[model samples]
Target: MRLRNATIAAASAVALVLAVPTSANAATGDFLYKVGPGIPAGLADPASGECINLFGATEANPAFAPENFTSSTATVFLDFDCDGDVFYVMNPGKRLGDRLKLRSVVFS
Candidate 1:
């Protein structure tokens, strides 16, 4: 009877310890961009990076100048200057190699 009661008590303690995190206070942190499956996302794909085409030329067969979209992509931080809208590509794992490519973006 003593051994069985001891085993039950130990199991109960373990369960309570594991459940503490869920009951504790939550934390807030800066957002990090999540890349694609192969490459990091949010980080603009430099293969076609450029100043003028940051938004994209869209039509006119390149518009004023012929540019490539992959040459100037970069990693950017997301911070709100004031009351405005913004978007971030969220990564589940947020691995280094995988966070540089564009993944599913989250918008507010």
Candidate 2:
């Protein structure tokens, strides 16, 4: 039947040009930082081939700096001044104030 309808329209035009969405599958952007005891700020400054990724962080070390209350460690530092900073490391026995509560995640 006309070469099977021209081989199914050339395999549906190569599956519609491989499903079109290119740019390496495009869609990359994310930023979020939170802290309760105060100390969490960094975002807004990245354009020049774009680069920034902290990606993970979670803190809730009441006051365990050197007490070694089991485990605790968090980090997210980028740019220093260009914008991006969230560092928390207290699990053993490090006491100061506020009680520390942080949540960070960044990517661009």
lDDT of 1 by residue, 1-108 (tens): 999999999999999998887522211223233222232113222221221122221222211111112222222222222112422222322323322222122222
Candidate number achieving the greatest lDDT relative to the actual structure = 2
Model 1 gets an lDDT of 0.29
Residue 61's lDDT in candidate 1: 20
Cα lDDT, all candidates: 0.29, 0.35
RMSD of 2: 11.3
What tens-digit string does per-residue lDDT give for candidate 2 at 1-108? 999999999999999999997653211222224332343433333222233342233232211111112222223232332244545433322332433333331222
State which candidate has the highest TM-score. 2
Question: Model 2: runs farther than 4 Å from truth?
Answer: 17-19, 22-30, 34-100, 103-108
